[model samples]
Target: MSTDTNTVTALPMRPVVADVLREAADADPRLVVLGADGQALAAGVRERYPERYIDVGIAEANLVGVASGLARAGRRVVVCAMAPFLVRRAAEQIRNDVANPGLDVTFVGVGGGLSYGTLGPTHHCPEDLGFFSALPHTRVYCPADVVDAAWAVRQALAVPGPAYVRLGARADRVVHAPDERFDAGTGLLMRPPGRALAVAAGAGVGIALDAADRLAGPGHTLGVLALTAVTPFPQERVRELAAGVDAVVVVEEHLASSGLGAATALALAGQWHGAFAAHSVHTGYPPIGDREELLAHYRITAGDVAASVLDAVRGPGAGARR
Candidate 1:
C-alpha cells in the first residue's frame, strides 16, 4: 500500500459531505450549489460560499433543471439535496436536460441508502446508483472514505457532463489517508492481501470491514475493497484485482441486482473471463431499521464479511479449499 499519508491537522474529521463540498468550493470558482436546506453539518457550505449556495426551497425538479441551465450558461454547477426527493422527483429533469445533453453538471446526493435510518424506506437511496448508471453521460462515485469523498467532489467538479456522488448522513469513518490518489473508474484495496475481497462502496465499506474483522480466523482473511467510483465501472482495474483473488464477496447498501456486485460480476465474466465459487453472495435491502441495526440484521458487518470468507474457505458451505 502507498505509505504517503497526505494528512493535515484538521479536526477528527466527521466524514461530512459538506466538508468535502466546502473543500471543493474553496478551490473551484465555477461551482454553484443548489439545495433545499439540510443537516447542520452541511450548513458550512452555506456560510462559506454564500453567493454560490442556493436554497431551492424543497423544489426537486427545479433543483435539477436550474442546474442544467446553469451548466449551459458556463457554470460548473452541482444540484445538492436529500437523496430520495432529489433523485426521484428530479429524475425527469436530469434525464431530459443534464444527462441527455451531457451537461457539465453534478449531483451531490446526501444521506444515500439507509443512512437516513429512522426516516424509513421512503428515504432509502438503494436505487440511486442503478438510476445514475443507466443515464447517458452520467458517472457516479460513492466515496468509501473521507479522503475519497473530498477528492471525489473535486474531481466531479472538474469533469464535464452529469456526475453523481453519494454522501452518507453521519460523521462516518475515514477509510484512507489524505494523499491516497483516486480517479473515475478506480477502486482502493482497503485491507492487506491473500484474502477474499469484499468489493463494496459507500457505507458498505464500513460494513464489509466489520465483517472481515469478525470473520477472520482458521484459514480465512476477508479483505475490504473500496470502490468509490461507480459509473463507467472501473473495468480494467477491477479485472486486474479479480484475476488474482480467490473469491470476491460484493456488498452494497443498494439493491442486489444493479449494485456493485452485479457490476463486478459482469466485468469478471465479460472482461476477465473468471468465475467465483457459488459461495459468493450479494446484499440487497435488508430488514429495515437504523443503519447499524440494518447492517447487523442483514449480516453485513465486518464480522459477517469475515464469516462469509471463512465459510467460503473451510465451512461446509465453503466446499473444498485444499
Candidate 2:
C-alpha cells in the first residue's frame, strides 16, 4: 500500500505470500502448501491448516514429486522453496511430472536472481525464466513487489496448469499502486509513454523506474515497462510500445542471453527498427557480495542502466548525448 517509489518496505512480499496462500486455502479446502526447507516462510499456513501443509526438508526434488503426485490426485498444490534449488534441483521432476501432465501446481521460488547475495551462484537463480518458460503447459511470473507478488500467487493458484513465481528475497519496492490492475501477459507501464522504453522485470523494475526518472527532461522522456509475467511473453504489448519508441533498453537481474531482455529482443525480431540494448547480468558465477554489491559488480545499477538507455536512445544519427 506504499506510494513512495524511492524506498522499499522490508519483508513485505514474503508475508504476503503466506497470507495469499492462507486465503486460497480458506477458499478451497483442496489447496495444499508444500515447502522445501521453506517452512518458516509458510509458517502461517502451517499454523492455520496443519492438515494441508507439508515440509519436505531440503529435498527439492522430492518436493516437486510430491506436489505433482498430489496435483494428479485432484489436489491444488503449491511448492514454496528457494529459487535455485526449486528450479534447478528438481528441474527434471518438474518437466516430467508437473508440466507433462499439466497439473495444478504452483511453484513459489524465493530469492530469485542475485537476491541470495553472498550465498554464491549455487543459490542464485538467474536462469529460472529460461528454464521455466521453455517448459510446455507452464507459465512464469517475475513480480516486482508485494502487489505483483500477491497477484502472481493468486493467478498461479487460479490457473489449472503448472506455474512458477520467481520472487525477490525481501524486496518490497512500491512500483504499483495498492489497487493496481494486472492482466497476465501484459507489461505495466510505470511511467508515461516516451520516445524510449526501459523494459524490466522482478527487482529490475524499480531500477528501470529510477533510471526513467533520472532521464526525464525537456526532450529525454523514457517510459518504464514492468514485465511481471515472463512466459506468454507480452508480444503484442511489447510490439505496440516498441512501435512508438525510438529506442528500447531491457534492464533485468538475469543473464542477458536468457532473461526478459532476451525475450524482448526476440519479440521485436524482424520488426521495430529502433536501437535496442539489454542491460543485464552478462557473466556467470559472479563474485561473492551482498545484493547491492553484486548488482554494482554486474553494472546492473540504476545509474548503469540509465547510461545504457541513454546510449541506445542516442545511437548513431540519433543526436549527440544530451
Candidate 3:
C-alpha cells in the first residue's frame, strides 16, 4: 500500500486540471474559471489566463452563484473548490441555479473522499456522488488519473448542462495509457479478462487495479472496470461488463450506500444473478488518519478488495484472506 514515487508516477490532478482548463480557455474566450479561495490549486490556469480566472474568496455559495450567472450569460464556467464545501455547503446554489436551469457549468470538486484525510470528516466528501447524481440535468465524473482528469474537463465543457468532476487533492497513480481514448459514459477495463470483475471509480480505480495484480499471484485473475463518469450511470455498459463474470465486486472510496457500489447494484438488479459484493466505507464518519491509513481502516485497500473478490469468487464462508 506504499505509494512509492519510483514504482508509479504520482501526477497531481489539480495542476493537470488547471493546465486543461487553461487550454480550454485559449480555445474559447467565454470560458471562465471560478474558485473559492482555491487559487493555489488553479494557479496554472490563473497565470496562463489571467483575464478568465476569478477568485470568489471563501464563500462557496457565492462561488456557485457566480459560475451559474456566468454560464447563463453564455460563458462556460468551471467552479473549483474543496469537495465538501462545493458539494455540501453550496448545494442549494448547485441545485437551484445550475441544475435547475440546466446551465453549462462544471463544478470541479478537489480533495474528494479522504484526500483531505487528516483534516477530519468535515473536509472529507464521501457523499458528493449521491447528492450531485440525484440532481436533475447534472453529469457526475470521478476520473482516476491525470489523463481522465483532463478528459473530464473537456467533456464537461462540451456538455450543455451542469457537470461535477470529483478529483483527489494529491498526485494520483497513473491508471490509464497516454493513447487511451476516454469515452465519457463508458467504463474502462484496466486489467485482463477474468472470471470476476472489480468495478471501481475515482481513486478506487487504482486500488482495484492493484488488487487485480495481487490476485494474479494466487492464480486468480480479476477484470477491473474503472468508471470515469458516474452519473448518466451507463446502465447498458455496466450490464454488459457483468454479463458472464462469475462474481462482481464494486469498490469505491465513498460510502457504499450511495456511491459506485450502490449505482452498480441498481444497474444490475434483476439482470445478473451472479455473486455480488461491495467494498467501500460504511455509514458514519471514518477515524482521523492519513489517506492510506484511512483506506486500511475502512477496509478499502487493495488487500481488502482482493480478499473480498476472493470470497465472492470462492463462495461465502470460504474465509479468503490477504
Candidate 4:
C-alpha cells in the first residue's frame, strides 16, 4: 500500500475482472472466457465479446474440460464461476487436465470464502487454497481489490502454466495505489514498520488494516503485510518482514489449517523465533449467515484481529526474544 492519498480508489472486483478479460480478448484473439451459467457477474465481457464467451450452464466439470481443451489448442482461457463449484466440483478436471498438463488456463473463482454465506456450506469455499495449492505446476492468487485483481488477470494471461484467482462477490475498499506494481511470489507492506506485524490475504487485508487502526487507539502500532499471491508463497519476503517484529499475526477468511496462516507459519519455520497468532475460519463448516455475521462468528473481525495481536505481543507466553 502507498502512503500517497491521491492514488487509491475503491471499486468492485467483478467489473474489473470483466473489463480486464474483455480488453485482453480484444487485444488477443487467443484469449477466451468460459462460464458455468454465471454470466450475470461477467455481463460486461459477454455483452462486448459474445463470440469469445461460452456459458457451460452449471456444468463445472465440463466447463474446466472445455477451457483446458481450448488452452491445449493454443488459446488462453479464463474460467469464471463461484469458488465452491469451480474448485471443488471440478477438482479432477483442474488437477488432471489443467495443472498436470501445464495448460494456459486461468480459473477465476468468484464469491471466495464466505461471500456466498447465505447459500450454506455447499456454496461457501474455504478449501480452494488447500486443494489448488496442493497440485503441482499451479499458481494461486487472492487479490485485495480491483487494482490487484486486474494485475492478477494480466499475469494469468501471460503465465505459461495453470493459475487460480480467487475473488469476492462485492467491492473491496482500496488499500493499494492504482499504479502499485504487482508480481507473483511477493508481498506488500500496507502500513509503516511497527513492533508487531499482521499478515493477511484477500479480503482480510482490509480487515487487518482496520484492526491496525483500532490498535493505534490503544497506543499500539501494528504493521500489516498483505499477500496477493498464495501459491509459490513468498517465503523470503515473509522472513524479511517477520524480522524485528515482536510478534506476527496472520488473518484470513479461509481455514487456518490451509490458508495464509499455515503458509506464513511454514515460511517462517526455523527462521523467525517470535510469538505468532493465527486468526482465520476454524476447521469446521460455518453456520449460514450473511458475510458480516459469518465473519463475526469465526472471530475474523477487526476487533478480534487486534485482540489477537495484543495477546501475541503481551500475553503470558509472549516472553521470548525476537
TM-score of 4: 0.92
lDDT of 1 by residue, 1-322 (tens): 2211333122222345567667667777777778776534346667887988877788899888888888899988877788888889988998998999999887888778777877777887778888888899888888866777777777787777889887777655665776888756567777754546677887777667666656556455666667888888887777777665566777777765777867878878855432242212234545658877875665556656665666556545343332
Per-residue lDDT tens digits for candidate 3, residues 138-250, read 99999988999888888988878999999998888887887788776677877754767888898888888888877875445888888898888888888897786767888
Q: Per-candidate RMSD vs. true structure?
A: 4.8, 2.5, 3.3, 3.0
Computed on alpha carbons, the lDDT of every model, listed in order, comes to 0.71, 0.84, 0.83, 0.83
Q: Each model's TM-score?
A: 0.83, 0.94, 0.93, 0.92
lDDT of 2 at 34: 95
RMSD of 1: 4.8
- Sorting all predicted structures by TM-score, with the top scorer first, yields 2, 3, 4, 1
Q: Mind giving the per-residue lDDT tens digits that candidate 2 earns over 1-322?
A: 2222545554457888888888999999999999976775587779998989999888988999999889988999999998898888899999999998899999888988889888888888888888888899999998988898999989988888999998888655667877998888677887865778888898788887777778878566878888888788998899898788778888888887888878899989987777788878876568889888888888887788778767766668453322
lDDT of 4 by residue, 90-149 (tens): 999999999999898888999888878788888788888778888889888889888899
CA lDDT, candidate 4, residue 279: 79
Clashing pairs in 4: none
Question: Where does model 3 exceed 4 Å of error?
Answer: 1-6, 217-219, 316-322
Which model, 2 or 3, shows the larger TM-score? 2
Instruction: Please list the residue runs of candidate 4 whose C-alpha ends up more than 4 Å from where it truly belongs after superposition.
Output: 1-10, 217-220
Cα lDDT over the full model 3: 0.83
